[model samples]
Target chain A: MARWEPNARERLVRAAIDLFAEQGYDATTVTGIAERAGLTKTTFFRHFPDKREVLFAGQELHSRTLAEAVAAAPAQATPLEAVAAALDALAATFTEDRRDFAARLLAVIAANDELRERAAFKHDQLAAAIAGALRERGTPGPAAGLAAELGVRAFDDAFARWSDPSVARTLTDLAREALDELRAALAALG
Target chain B: MARWEPNARERLVRAAIDLFAEQGYDATTVTGIAERAGLTKTTFFRHFPDKREVLFAGQELHSRTLAEAVAAAPAQATPLEAVAAALDALAATFTEDRRDFAARLLAVIAANDELRERAAFKHDQLAAAIAGALRERGTPGPAAGLAAELGVRAFDDAFARWSDPSVARTLTDLAREALDELRAALAALG
Candidate 1:
């Protein structure tokens, strides 16, 4: 069904980012975004429920990928190991191709308090999804929740590192390094 | 100044919570809350900037408590220990007298996605405050951020436990237990 719409989703997302960057998020509207994309408002609605959704459409994909990766980890892997695996898989999706878009999107979000709140909620949602996956893999209670949160923090640090223009490292490499730093930090706490 | 205002803030908060719980957050208005509290709209505005503020008036106090506790920790304490001290001090403020209010507030926030987003924002604010305090004490990035986040998670879990009707533990005790569990969990990550 989505194939029939060609690149409507991508076009809408790009149009949103461009308009948001040009005029600020508060000044942008769904209708204006659709027009910028050379698409109808109806077509825009089919892809996203709201203007904000355009900036966050990839969340479901990211969450699904994370959960699936955790679930597919080796049976003997510890909770933290499974979480690290899940984060590595998710980091791979943030390939170099998306770096420019991510940087711009983060700038727009950083400028708006509402968007920052939405980002926090999105992070919590991913943590919860990852925790659910860990629980399914037999990790219990606070362990699963703690490991899930640590994974998200590592992803955040790695993504920020990867987004830096001066950093030539891949997102996967950055993520692994970030996880190692966090694990060492945790061990130091002991 | 606040003493002259008597319990006007408390009255307004109680009225807002009762009205919100009865008629829902969206349906409850400032005017209705003021009327219920035997106060004028002007008085209500003087106490709270908005309806939502009535439910979250303690945030500033909580943030201050956390930052102060972190700052007051022994200079020799590790980043994680400083964070634990902050959580402990903040938790001590949540005496059994506030349990019912905390439970109701959590219920209201949970029922409304907008409120929940605001709650997440509040959590982020506290985390930032803790991180700032930790940095002030010479802790560096990633270490301060991660420790602050772990502290917030411990407070959250402990608060939930303390709010449980079947649980008779003091918030301070619950917090200690929660932080201990988190520390063990983090160590097990190794």
Candidate 2:
């Protein structure tokens, strides 16, 4: 039987990110990540399937968080309102302590084509999750999808801004502001 | 010196799609695709970087077509109007002759995770190209991005509908209708 490791996942992620940043993502290996975290390769495999997946650690949990929040919105709430609530829930997961890590993660992803592609897939998945939740709440197809897209765009834009060390606003506040900007921009599309 | 092969790209694409549909994507290989196409592996490499890229053959040309159309829209055209023109231009490339191919291509992509990720990346790239062109034409940041996303969504939805053998409408018409429906859905978002 394998011994239980404390915060093994978190430690592995930090180690992977540090290694990726130092030696470049392509040069980093699973064994190196495991060794850096003081864990066995088996422990690393238990948490992540590969080095690339380590960077996308919370994808499933984030998707669930967004969907559950959208599902829990008031029955009478508009699609956009539900999306707003979902963004709040997602943003809450990115507390102040993770801001620097978020910035570094963004830089690493931006530097690599495979990582960028994976990021785009994750973005689409998140939007789809929000859209599915809205549809379950009786929102029509197009509107559900559009509202979900807006929510994701807002969260993504706000995340980029929040990752900047100079930005003092909370992720939730930035997301709300970005969503409002997009809502206002819709009228100007004409 | 290598002998030139006529329609090598097209032949390779058709062969890949057929092979992927027959034996499944994972079971297929570049050498197998080249052999089925009656071309050499070197010729296949000349056209596509890998087997997966064979399915996304016209990606660069499609992006260029969309961006150029958006850039060439009338000076007074609204952002959405520019996107509509871009969609029409893009749809023209997918004539009736290509409908069956498009359907097969979509099915092959739908069955594979790696291909789906590539598709999402391509989708984002197309949207970004349109957004960049819109920005060049004086459209603001948020509105340009929102309009570009709507255009991509409309075209994607229209392509799916047009892929059905029973759908008689032209790709252009379906895209226009889809865009109009999304525009109307915007009003119901709140």
Per-residue accuracy of model 1 over B47-66 as CA lDDT, tens digit each = 78889888889889999999
Measured against the true two-chain complex, the DockQ scores of the candidates, in the order shown, are 0.69, 0.73
Instruction: Pick the lDDT winner.
Output: 2
Tens-place lDDT digits, model 1, residues A82-137: 98899889987776888988788889999998888888888888998899999998
Query: Once superposed on the true structure, which residue ranges of model 2 sit more than 4 Å away at CA?
Result: A1-3, B1-3
**Model 1: residue A124 alpha-carbon error in angstroms:** 0.7
TM-score, candidate number 2: 0.97
B1-190 per-residue lDDT for model 2 (tens digits): 3446888889999999999999999999999999999998999999899999998888889899999999999999999999999999999988799999889999999999889999999999999999999999999999999999999999999999999989999999999999999998886764
Report the lDDT tens digits of candidate 2 across residue range A111-172. Answer: 99999989999999999999999999988999999998999999999999999999999999
Candidate 1 runs further than 4 Å off: A1-4, B1-5
